[model samples]
Target: MISAISGSVAQSFRPPAISLAARGTESVQPKGSDSGKSSRLGALTEEQKKQVEQLKKTDREVRAHEQAHKNAGGQFTGSASFGYTVGPDGRRYAVSGEVPIDVAPVEGDPAATVSKMTIVASAALAPAKPSGQDRKVAALATSIRTEAQAELAAKSRDKLSGKDESDSKSSALSAQAAYTTGSSPEKGSQIAGSLLDLFS
Candidate 1:
């Protein structure tokens, strides 16, 4: 029921490279040292250049944060991942069977609870008219969130309250805070930010 691939093969599975122009990189311009290494910008305006540069900047910033997370021991949970991937045709998609929320819940932590509900909120917020990843994520998120809210509402105040609890319960409560709108990762899609929204 499980399959694995080697790290080298996995590393090779990268997205298409961005052109220098697309990445908004500068040319090497030293005094009397034009060694023919230059970006090929064919007719793109200054505004276009700036826009491409901004996109590159955002891409790098996001990746750096991601690396920092991993460096600090952040790992993917049942609710995290690209719900859909972009294809050669430049279209976005996720196969029908691979929805992130469908992954089995990681039990015993409040962070797991928040991860579940955060995904539910995102899925609920996806476009209603579109019949695609947006629709799927939104729909799934809504369903999960609905189920969770009902479940949470049924718990006694003593259970949900934090006056005094075990370490596991307290940590879980802290992790669950991400779904409450004020948490760092919950403010945007860093943790549950829409995949579709990222490219947009």
Candidate 2:
């Protein structure tokens, strides 16, 4: 009673591209060019621009590290994928599945073992969540799309010309980080800073 795809389930656990940005690093900017440009940073004051540029340099370093990881053939476990497989009956097959977690026992809780077993069993038995990876992806996609839409909306709302959409979007993004992330004020500020540069 085994299905054709059942054999390849192991391959389905391969990593995926969950990163908001693409792989690779800039091949050294022309003497004075802006590599990996950001419109939001472009709008900042001179002092702020210096800070943003420093951050950009730091981000470029991070991306280089990530690219090294990508080159080594690592993938994001969170992404869903299918893989090719071979069954005991000597047939090639394809199967789709998620990254399986090996739930170990917790020190103080006897129920932890039962809870892990129940989670694994339930994942096998229950229907998949509707939103799926699409929603997780939407976070990045919407960050751009929603930013564009909000930028237009800001033009209409402000009337006067001092502020731009990127500014408003950055502020709103900060508020979202504050509300959803629920980090301490300092950590929240740091997350907001990273999000602004990465998303904008």
Candidate 3:
């Protein structure tokens, strides 16, 4: 028996940071911290400029990653939410983001469950660089798909067996009728041949 589908939360690309400044600068004030406080009014130092660019790149990647999930997931996913970090240029950038997706299996319909799980797994892996949490969700989806496929196979086997049993009963009735009617040897042989054909 397959286990119940695990609940999947939003998958984030990275952890949020307070700032993108260098390690030692967190507590120390910059040379002109007061005057150059606003990013629009001051020329950024070389380090600050580099940090800003890095933040911008990170922001773009995070948004794009979440967007991929949203696009593939469609109605099953919620809007992308971001975790922000203040850059050295006094601007907020997205350091991490997540898109929540529905991962529950379809009830009572293994075929539908398989279809839904396929989509869920695709959505989980939609991003170019899938996070660990994303991979976990995809794995869960695969498990669900496997279980549903087994169920569908079982149903097909049950249907075929029931049909075979009905055919066997009909063939037995025909043979019994031939015997009760005191049919000719040729007719009895023909009925036996038919029964053999049915079984074969």
Candidate 4:
């Protein structure tokens, strides 16, 4: 995707100054037409709306992610994208990609993945903090975390099977010993030979 500064994006493509009315209502869809759509709107499709909502979430993430830079007393050139749309409340909300690679913590170990998930989940689930943007940001994080958990789980299952298979081999050996009850020397020799064959 062509990456450009958010400000440059806004200035470069000026959607006709929508009426103050649309700006107030933020409805990209046409009103009173009963069509539930717009011809001129660069308005998002259902999927695009979902994408934009996901992107808009980066705004909240920007707030959270940039804090690290601020604490370190560094200049934050944190970036975001634009999904051009007028909101229902008649405001211009710039949409961008949510959960930029740099914004969300990387998923490595399973426990670490869970930790990242918990932190983002806590921010989303908190009752006292009343920011829609925060909720979206957390939602994006939760999405990534869920994916990480699934990856970790699949890896664990594959690893788990190796150990389980070893246990099965041991059980087979025990079964062989138990069945070799006839203790005559010839029988013992045959049993030992059979056990060796099984191992081989």
Per-candidate clash tally: 5, 2, 0, 10
Give the total clashing residue pairs for model 2.
2
Q: Write out the backbone clash pairs for model 2.
A: 5-94, 16-76
TM-score of each: 0.27, 0.23, 0.74, 0.36
By lDDT, the better pick of 1 and 4 is: 4
- Residue-wise C-alpha lDDT for candidate 1, range 1-200, written one tens digit per residue: 00011222211111233212112122233334233213333345677566556544544543343233223222321222222323222222321111122323335444465575464444323322223443444454456556555555656466756445676787787777765655654445563557667778
lDDT of each: 0.38, 0.38, 0.73, 0.47
In terms of lDDT, the poorest run of 10 residues in model 4 is 1-10
* Candidate 1 regions with alpha-carbon error over 4 angstroms: 1-103, 108-115, 123-131, 154-200
Error of 2 at 197 (Å): 63
Q: List the residue pairs that clash in candidate 3.
A: none
Worst 10 residues of 1 by lDDT: 1-10
Better of 2 and 4 by lDDT: 4
C-alpha lDDT (0 to 100) for residue 110 of candidate 2: 39
Worst 10 residues of 2 by lDDT: 1-10
Task: Specify the highest-lDDT model's number.
Answer: 3
Return the lDDT, model 1, position 145. Answer: 52
TM-score of 3: 0.74
The segments of candidate 4 whose C-alpha lies over 4 angstroms from its true place after superposition are: 1-102, 105-107, 124-129, 175-200
The CA lDDT at 87 in model 4 is 48
- What does the lDDT read for residue 73 in candidate 1? 22
